[model samples]
Target: MTRCRLCGSTALESVVDLGATPPCESFLAAERLDAPEPTYPLHLRVCTDCWLAQIPPLITPEETFSEYAYFSSYSSSWVEHARVFVEDAAARLGLGEDSFVVEVASNDGYLLRHVVDRGVRCLGVEPSVNVGAAAREAGVPTLTAFLSPETGAAVRAEHGPADLVVANNVYAHIPDVIGFTQGLRALVADDGWVSVEVQHLLTLIEENQYDTIYHEHFQYYTVASAIRALASGGLTLVDVELLPTHGGSLRLWARPEEAAGEPSGRVADVLAREKAAGLQELSGYTEFSARVAKVRRDLLRFLVEAAEEGKTVVGYGAPGKGNTLLNHCGIRPDLLPYTVDRNPYKHGRYTPGTRIPILPPDRIAADRPDYVLVLPWNLRAELVEQLSYVHEWGGRLVFPIPELSIVEVER
Candidate 1:
């Protein structure tokens, strides 16, 4: 019995298997084109007792997020999402003079700006040195260190207990799941609340979002698993809400165990729905390997067929998720030719493993591809709308996961 890493639960059921692939951030060095790479099996498992979704240990966060290449500000959608989170949190916390909010992994101070705008004092705990520097430059007070029991105590000493602690889509990225939760307990005020947002594991499996199978995300989550994990650190979940951001995600509101109120109907409803949908049951997750393998096969088939028909095939978005899908599908420069990105840091680089060149998005119109693969399938709408001129040349767009389909939208 492979026990759950956080809760030590022996009853784990396989949710889905994504086979072996390089880490999402394993972008190759320019000189190591032929260097051998190690790819780990990307598998999802659900803890029966705690109802937490996770993968067997395969990689470490130090191997995934340290020396990171991704920046949250690179995406327009995420930036807007941060702005909204800050606004709502400030109002909900009744934050203003004499109130303070703190964010863990506050990349580029993207979300904290909203709290700052409300005059609610704010601070950021960022581990990535480069990204943390960027946040500091933007005038967000950022502590460039990992959030841990020791650091949490030290921060509490300096800032006192935080009235609100926000962690957006970072729970799954943490390597020490229990340690991370414990830190939250130590840092949050006695009467204050903590909100954590994570990609919904059930949605990821149901929608076949294999692109999110990066090493950085060690655990996928459902309400049952999350509540149980936090409880170990003397915290209790009070409410839960499903959000549409990041394909799909869960926003959890929690407080100290003693201060927690009766669990809301909102929490019970989602748990019941997830259980009915077989989120924690073994049989429900057993059929996953076949579904994801089909996606890999179907994508290669579509791109290869398009190539045979003399249609120029290119790619959109240089996101880490895109890297996972493309590399796992065994895409090479010959098949994809080149992809384009809006982020300047990625534009002139090549994707890891696949070695496909990445250029600026403008190059897409210049090349005028007959079919452009939308790598960030989550942003299909915006990409299609922005790149609608592809239709001027009778070009089509492709969305690979969930199913391989092409769309022709009018400008």
Candidate 2:
């Protein structure tokens, strides 16, 4: 039996099983398509002790992140979101030219670029070489290394303790939650703040966002569970904000337990919400498997009906979440045929497991398929706006999660 990573408890209850799937971001080159692709069981379990939803670490971080394929700059909306966050955080934290900022898992320096624009001293620590190089090219000093207690000490020695440590969308990717949080504590100055963003487990279960369950994300957190995790690393929650990113996420601000800061009312408000939602009990997670199974059935039914009607369907984004959805539903190129992505790195590659060929966005306009499946459904509005011209060809957009539905695009 796999023990829970957070509390080291053996009493882990099954939440949802996605069966075996390749690393979601493992886009394959044409030359490598003939080679065998490795897959691991993608099962999620909730810790009865800590109430943390997590998956077993089937793959190492090096294998999943090194030379990574996902780049943040490709999504204009995401970049703009980062820009807004930097602007707000800098002002709220009273950051100045002398204040040092550090971002962990800073993909393509998307957020830190805004920090630099304000003349603040900032650094990005990205494990992915491809994206780290991009960050460096964009004039953001980046360190290509994973954040751990040891690495954190090394970073603090090289560059003085940071005044603001930002870790957005990285809390879930970390398997060693305790160690990573400790590292955050080590890198931040005594008075500095550590900000973390994680997709709320309540949203995942409520919205049926099973697609977000993949190898890359090891653990999901609720406000209560996140506080427990941070406390284990000698940090105390000072504030919490509910963000709309990643469907629904929690942006938590913390500081060393010794630091002087009162808990914000938002913290109590979110904790009460989680309590009412039953996130504190294992019973809350029991029905998740059934919901995920229903999503699979619904998605498969839609694809089969579309195929029977001779409807040509393609995908919009090659995001990791989309891969989980595809692999979990057992979708192949026969159903999806091909998908398009804005990232040139994925253009000529094939999606892992499904082996669906990925093409450029221009292919969509050239072929003008009858239906387009917006894979990253969280960005549906942005994608709809970008592909509004699809209405010119009488094409409709489809969303598979939270139930499969077809949407008519307005001209």
Candidate 3:
């Protein structure tokens, strides 16, 4: 964009241009296959002033989240991650029956269910109607609305200031970063804790995780930039924890400035790491574009060689990141043929730009394909165990990110 979304600065440098592609989560129905699909420029830039990396606000949250297809409960590891977070947060924050908990963008009540089980009052503020309905059906109180300054204040007034506000994997989804952060401030008590988990830009660059950049993710944050973003809404970063989720992520603990005394040593430690990695300057981003090009070349080469050898190569998991990888590499059904997923909503649909069919998880076993190209490589550990049956027929699993590697499962 001409101006940075966060700092409003006119100086924005190129990080990587992923070319134009449709929304990553936009799966096409059979009826719409013949119709035309729209695409937008997927260029990511970093602001020279604030060092915040972002893409243009080409798509709005309403367009994507109104009836979102992603369900957090589909990933067993993610659900367990949520459960453990709830347990730890409860014990750490001294939450009990009297504590009020609120989770923004909570999908399908995966995390809040643990809070509900503990008999604490909790609510999920989600924008997607389908997932929010699923949350309600699971006995979790849910509000089907987007988070804003006014919305957060209303929640605080009606239910009283929340003791704990959990926002996981959603800090980068909203375009209005300032407004969204203000909403978080409004929902939390003056002394309450706000926990946010987002993909770490440092690891994203070091690990060659460019596929994570998509239209839905508006911005990527380093600890330094994240500190500035938090202060924009009067929230102070008090603690920071590095997590292994989403390849690599940061768990930020914040509070209102009045109660946020001094940041923990971890904050400085992360900032130091970011500085050493050259993220605070322009040098870190200079080689990213070249590295990204290498990844695309390597993946396309593998698919071509596999085809020539008569080795069938299909995909596993139709995640949004997978769509980014597919569209960037210009892969179609000719190369990938089809993919399988656990979410039933995508069973009969096709990936937006690539037009690859999505089938059920059992199809891999039924067809016994020679090779299964895994799209959701972030869930490598959990998916490997789930797909160990591939070993029965000598079928192998392929991972495309951080480097392309093939695994021979031994059951």
Model number with the top lDDT: 3
For candidate 2, list the clashing residue pairs, or say none.
none
Error of 2 at 174 (Å): 1.3
How do all models score by TM-score? Answer: 0.95, 0.98, 0.99
Q: What does candidate 2's lDDT look like per residue over 266-292, in tens digits?
A: 999999988887888877878989988
Off by over 4 Å in 3: none
Instruction: Report the C-alpha lDDT of model 1 over 1-411, residue by residue, as the tens digit.
Output: 288878787987776666677777776655666778788777777777777777666777666655667788877778888888777877887888799788998988888766777777888998888888888898888998788878888899999999998988889988688888989988999989999999887788788887887777888888888888788777899999898877889999999988997989999999998889887677667777789889999999988898899889999888889988987788998899999888776766678778888889889888888998998888766677887888988989999977998999678
Task: Flag clash pairs in model 3.
Answer: none
Worst 10 residues of 2 by lDDT: 1-10
Ranked by lDDT, the better of candidates 1 and 3 is: 3
Clashes of each: 0, 0, 0
TM-score of model 2 (CA atoms): 0.98
Please give the lDDT score at residue 399 for candidate 1: 93
